[model samples]
Target: MLLGCLPGLAAVLALALCAGGVERSVAASGRQVVARPAAAHKAVRPHIVPRSVWLDDDTRHAQPPPRYDDRVIAVFVHHTDSPNGYDCADAPRIIRYLYAGQTGSRDWDDIGYNFLVDRCGTIYEGRAGGIDRPVTGAHTQGFNHRTTGIAALGTFTAGVPVPKEMTDAIAALAAWKLGLSGTDPRARVRLTSSNSHSRYAAGASTTFPALAGHKDGYMTSCPGAALSALLPGIRETAARLQGRH
Candidate 1:
């Protein structure tokens, strides 16, 4: 009788690792106990167009396999630095152009950004890796690992009228990506710099907003002034999406 009870006890202990809620029987107390895992604070993943939509085999470059980190704790926003007055229907061509420039002239393994958002609010996967995975990007100089890079499809210099649709999509993507690691969009996270080209020296540790601009980690005007000004509101929106206050 004792040996049989031991196996039942072990099964009940394993319930703690399960996500959501689980119930266990308490024979001694003649009551049921509920065991729930800690809340993940995850948000529903926003729709993202796959890389194949932009980079076909004809245009695809032969690059090494993608690299990854444990999880994404932050997001670095950027702009493609191209003209903004483009038809949303032409977004795929624009992305392909950017990909050519990066992999051809810049000699990067792949497109730097992990994701890109068009002015019409369409989100597209930029890099080769899975969007749900923490694929290290080349968007930020030193803080690429453990962070996601989201590029606005066009330039957003000061006084530019950033599209509300675009910003909304960015917020949703950020919320989902950051939530995967239980990171709050409005909070700060500590990260180590891997390159001296960044604002922080190599090996330096610093704290930055979980949702931040490219300038936050590197010395650049990327994600531009107009977009940078919207970051606070974006953070709030992202947090709300994640079910955070």
Candidate 2:
């Protein structure tokens, strides 16, 4: 009987080795590569954020995202704050910004973020999910395991202020997303708050990562001076949503 089971045991041992190797491979690649959505497949959908919620209608939406996705990490905020005006009237304008202009040679085909928050505080949606699926995009520098993007208006370097409504939108969206991840069967997420240092901070990832500034992880200055300064406040608002406060 013992010899009869030897082959099965060997097979089990081999399988375990393969599983362990895969885990290490994932960690080595970092969350970004593993979490990024495959560009070959994107859904056809539009998620629009009205102007009342925006501080200004100066930003555009990108192409749709995957039909169904759920792995999101931290929220990355930046100041499109571009002096050069963009189409901004609607999502098509956004698609132009992401695909046209200096595509950074990547020809990404869409905006680099998952969402856009304007000066007025209204949130215009970007990166639609595929056919009732979840969505993911490129925004955060690293830590894409469960990350989303939020681009604001005006240049903090140019002396722009991060408004109260902007924070409100961030909190509202973060809360909504966190709750969604917990219940959404389509999205297989692992985090809830902002905890990624590459994207958030140490305490931020308690459940889900916290809202963060683009400069937090990247060397280039982005999200603007005023908005970057408000990272903590944004996180607090999100925390309150989860009863962390």
Candidate 3:
């Protein structure tokens, strides 16, 4: 009887040892997981919109590289004030034409807007400055500093049909650009007026929508009445893209 009981005891001891080993292994794994850096668990960045540079026929140059602002807190939407009827394939040509007029006729150092979008929903890099940097644009009169300018390729006066593709692209661009600074696209930001040309006096601080129309900061009816009407929808779309839904 004693010998039989001894064999059973040995089996129990082996099972207990196996259980202890498993618990130890699990504890070790937990420790290793806890040792990982906090940054390793950070959320992934949001999607970035694709953009194109100057086309083959496009003449792109900035004699003196465009100046840069510290950061962009707002974005102003505009219309190129060009013809609305054109083939999407000819977007590059259209852009080249605009560039020539600005740099050649206007004698500006570079294109005014930081970005341009075609009716086909294509986004183009403008202004000869680094797209990711806060390049000061010549688009807005007094709100250039800490702001970005995105021009829609065609005219959008009152009653003109605004393309869904164009508006969608604009929303995407606004969301991504503002996300770099952790700005909420639906929020309002206060900016100091740099010139008296705009509605506000120079050095006067005023609050404006994060995603604004050209006319929001200036007296010109740029971006058109048709496009201006879409600003609210664009802001909502941008905010949704930034995870603010």
Q: What local distance difference test score does each model get?
A: 0.81, 0.45, 0.71
Q: 36-119 in candidate 3: lDDT tens per residue?
A: 222211112333332344534346545695688888889989887667788988887776776665666556666677888889
Model 3 is weakest, by summed lDDT over 10 consecutive residues, at 13-22
Q: Rank the candidates by lDDT, best first.
A: 1, 3, 2
Question: Which lDDT tens digits does candidate 2 get at residues 54-165?
Answer: 2223443343435333544355566554432433345344333432332323444344556666544566765544212235555544433456666664445535556687
Show how many residue pairs clash in every candidate, following the order shown.
Answer: 0, 39, 0
Per-residue error at 183 for model 2, in Å?
12
lDDT (Cα) of model 2: 0.45
- Per-residue lDDT for 114-156 in model 1, tens only? 9999999999999888988999887787788899889887777
- Local error of candidate 3 at residue 15 (angstroms): 86
State the displacement of the C-alpha of residue 23, model 1, in Å, after optimal TM-score superposition.
19
Runs off by more than 4 Å, candidate 1: 1-37
Question: How do the candidates rank by TM-score, highest first?
Answer: 1, 3, 2
What TM-score fits each model?
Answer: 0.85, 0.54, 0.77
